[model samples]
Target: MKRSSDRTIKWLILLTPTVTIGLWEYTRHAFLLPYLSMELGNFLAPFIVLAVTLTLVLGLFRRLEQSQRALRRQQAATASLEERESLARELHDGIAQSLFLLAVKLDQLDRTAQDEAVKELSGQLRETVREVHDDVRQAIANLQQPPSPASDAWVVPLRELLGDTAGVLEAKAEFRWTIPESRLTGKEKVELHACLREALINVRKHARASRVYVVGESEEGGGFRCSVEDDGVGFDGDPMKAKERFGLKMIRDRAAKIGWTFSAERRGELTVVELRKAGADA
Candidate 1:
């Protein structure tokens, strides 16, 4: 509607001078010719036309400015809401995942409580608690930090997560990032990081891989593709049997939720999990 109004305003601006001139000419020749002399009317016509034309043009331009300002405010509000959602996802991936891992460790300790040495169990429990505390502190710090515009703002934390996962699995991990242009939106970045984190965790828990390789690259047409490849024994049964594995289901659900393509397959000696956004390859 604003665009249509802008077009109409432009046309009106163009016609303002013409309409004013025509009205002045009509009044001077037909209505006021007897009352006012032709010489005086001719002298006054240009000034009258200029005044009316300025008034109409200025008023239309002011309205256009007001419309543009309103549009800008709306866009800013949308962006702010998206940023908040991104922050929420970040918190989920960070603090929530840490708590889940802590729970798993505690469950493991409980199961082995009858068999394991008391000293060893106590040590593991303390370490797990410390790790959880650190994660919570880091998450709070991240929440308080101002938003960053840097393209690689997500890189550092993702690398750290992969490294930590590799340590847990006692496997070698390597990451290659070839994102020449980081044009990902806030939601896309959050989903991408979460997907990669889930992939590494899956590898750590299930894949008996000695080495893992993660790659993020620009795709051909215009989009991005990230793959987690491991030289591990791949899934033996149907990969899509979601009921059997909760982690795979979570990863797939997140990708689907965010409108990204996700696939996991065994390619010879390597199992690969890939995520791709539709138009971010460039």
Candidate 2:
């Protein structure tokens, strides 16, 4: 039914201009031709009116087309972002928290171990549990982070998100953010926050190192770059193949939604995730 309606609308759109042009041509040749009078400007009157009206109508149509295109783009971006947020929440609230509890139990078991063999096993188990705990904690933090507000009212506080993420991993996660003193628009802030969160989450889950660095810097060209880097068990193969994981898909979707460029790669033992805002050449 919807398709049929759309088809009808399309046919009407296609026919309206044709019909109008045919009527104008007919009127010019049949009605106005016999009454042509150059001295009184009567001969040019119908032509002049038709030209003006056509110009106005065409201009209006162009504006409407542009508006519709903009609306569609915005809607698509919004839907993609929402989907990413939902996936992030599910990972954080369900998988990550559960793993964190398991890690706590493993810590308790480690402290209660007395025998040498049991102690050695418990120590290994504790390390594994800690790793899992850190991963989950990072996921939760990323998932729970609030989207940036829509007004130019305030910027999403990057310091808070960074601090919380660092605490979760118990690692030396340092942040260096440099934005203009002026506040960011709500949409810009939200996109930046989402990109940063995904990058940090990737670092926590994939990088096994004790140190991570996150930086956000606005470029001179009115765009920004956010990067996350860590020395960990980086993948040996293609970055695209590595990112085939579910979490990476969410990150990609979020970046695409915001019209940002996302790239991930391993340098030596370090994994780096970078997101660049679209501006100019972006």
Candidate 3:
């Protein structure tokens, strides 16, 4: 009911000026024009008023459009954030808990297995389970929150995450970071670090490469570019097909969410992942 009333009011408001102007013009022509000439002032006055009134209406329309756009953007951002939170909760409550239970089962098997080989297999299973658990926990933790605001010293934390990943993979990883030693906003650092981690994880899982190299440098524009390269048995399938893998999907989503360009391709025997931050050329 209120909305109907508001709509009616808007229509009335819009038509009132037009009706008044028409009525005044008709009245002036029929009554006043016999005694008074339609001089320049008399001719221009109604048009000037109409112009001012139309200008105000147009301005109001523009403001309404802007407000609607802003509201849509805010709603989209809120929905995205809620989805991430739900994903994190599911991972923690479902996959993570399942892995823990599997670890416990392996522990029990270790005690009951009679053959030495069976015992060794159980130990390996336990270790694998633990590694999986850790990886899932890290992924959940990373996705649970938004990126911190941009800061001057972003690369430091990224370097740490990379170093940790290298240790976890037990692979030889080298960093060629060139970001300036300035404080980066929290948001910038988190995104940069996430990109680097995704690249390294891909290398560790699929590349089967012994050595990995991470290079970070200032892009020609304002932002930066980071590349991870590994000399491994490169995949032969289409890159899009490979994205069916959850890890690759997550990497792509994270890059896109942060307004970064992400590409992965196999160059001969080397699998390379590149990330580019956009709109930095201020």
Best by TM-score: 1
Question: What lDDT score belongs to each candidate, Candidate 1 first?
Answer: 0.77, 0.66, 0.72
Off by over 4 Å in 2: 1-157, 181-183, 242-244
Which candidate has the highest lDDT of all?
Answer: 1
Candidate order by decreasing TM-score: 1, 3, 2
Give the TM-score of each candidate: 0.45, 0.41, 0.42
- Residues 222-276, candidate 1: write the lDDT tens digits: 5778889999889878777846577777778999998878899988888999988
**Per-prediction CA RMSD (Å):** 14.9, 15.3, 14.4
Q: Count the backbone clashes (under 3 Å) in each candidate.
A: 6, 0, 15
The sequence of per-residue lDDT tens digits that candidate 2 reaches over residues 170-220 is: 777776667543324567667767766776776666666677877767775
Ranked by lDDT, the better of candidates 1 and 2 is: 1
Number of clashing residue pairs, candidate 3: 15
| Residue lDDT tens for model 3, 16-86 | 57776777778778887777678953876678567856776566555556556556656766786789789
TM accuracy, model 3: 0.42
